[model samples]
Target: MGQRTLVVVPRPDGGFDCRYAHWGVTTDPFSGSRPLGRDWSGTAVCAELDAGYDRLLVAAARPRWYCVCWLDPTLTDPDDVVLARTDDPDRLRERWTEAKSRAVDAVARGTAPDAARAALLLGLARRADACHRADDASFLRDDG
Candidate 1:
């Protein structure tokens, strides 16, 4: 099966909006292959990068959703504090890719119990990073 990911976006009212992403774990959501039948994928997204980016971020603010790299869908979570931020998509992709590899390695080396749990938490933590950044970006837009 494809790397199944639970895409979570924190709602502004103190909750989360989530969906099951059947693909897009290690792949670029803006280029190459994408999840079959996903509305947020490939050329459709590339055609309107900024608008697409806005849509993805606004999921937490207004409603909607990818630059899988900046989207960094793999390594984000809502509670994370941004250590540093970069607007470069390539750099973000590298960061998330490294994180994903580490989790996969943990699954490989871990014993049965730890393996299963680690596997589950693999892409769970960093989702909030995306949400928070998105929220900030949205706020900036509203202000300006």
Candidate 2:
């Protein structure tokens, strides 16, 4: 069976929740059974990404909420913080495309997992950093 990344988000009460299946087998909502499916469509992935972004926006206002991508099941640490929150949906969509493209390219070129995963992880980190900087700049402007 092929491996898939599960997107995990923080719950309001505490603990984390796995929300999305990146690729491979996913539970069929109607039947409550796992279905064999390879290659999650880009649209579906983007939808999940959007949901994660929404959670980040909510977290920004509430401070206790957050979302993250769970790359390794054995560990609880988040591989990527889903902080690409933005008013423009298209921007987040573009980020999804870019990240996926980098991952696919790495796999195609036979890059090791360490290098391949880093490309996607770096993309996510950069997006989060950009959002943070924007938030910081806005706060400063408002305070000044």
Candidate 3:
């Protein structure tokens, strides 16, 4: 099976809600005509999934306004976490650039490249890219 990604966002009650995308299914209930699924609480749900809740804590450390946690299954233990505060798209772009640079540097320094780290970085980069593309598409659609 291919890699799976779970995204968690904050809810009003100061807890978190999560959704995942894998195979041909996505927990984004709004993406289709299907009925909406109940929001999964971060702590309880992550525990149930056997994914570490520490990652959610890391994501929560950022400003609480609009942050997100990206859980990638391809990453190794303890490093599969990416916390992004999505209020500013520029921040996401910067993160992606920095991660890519770090991955490249590790390879160039003759150190064994960390596959999990690299995979997580690439996942973040893709997410950042997708966010920007969605913004552009929305803008174009509005203009048209």
| Local distance difference test, each candidate | 0.35, 0.37, 0.38
User: Candidate 1: lDDT of 112?
Assistant: 54
Q: Each candidate's TM vs. the true structure?
A: 0.27, 0.35, 0.33
For 1-144, candidate 3 gives per-residue lDDT tens digits of 432333344556745555454422223322522221345444444343322321111123242211133333323443244444244444554565466566656656664556635565457656542221111212111211
Please rank every candidate by TM-score, starting with the best: 2, 3, 1
Error of 2 at 144 (Å): 20
Regions of candidate 3 where Cα sits further than 4 Å from its true position: 1-18, 21-29, 32-39, 44-79, 94-98, 107-144
**Which residue pairs show backbone clashes in model 3?**
none
In terms of TM-score, the best-performing candidate is: 2
**lDDT measured at residue 23 in model 3 versus the true structure, 0 to 100:** 28
- What does candidate 2's lDDT look like per residue over 70-101, in tens digits? 22222223333333433443455556556666
The CA-based lDDT of model 3 is what?
Answer: 0.38
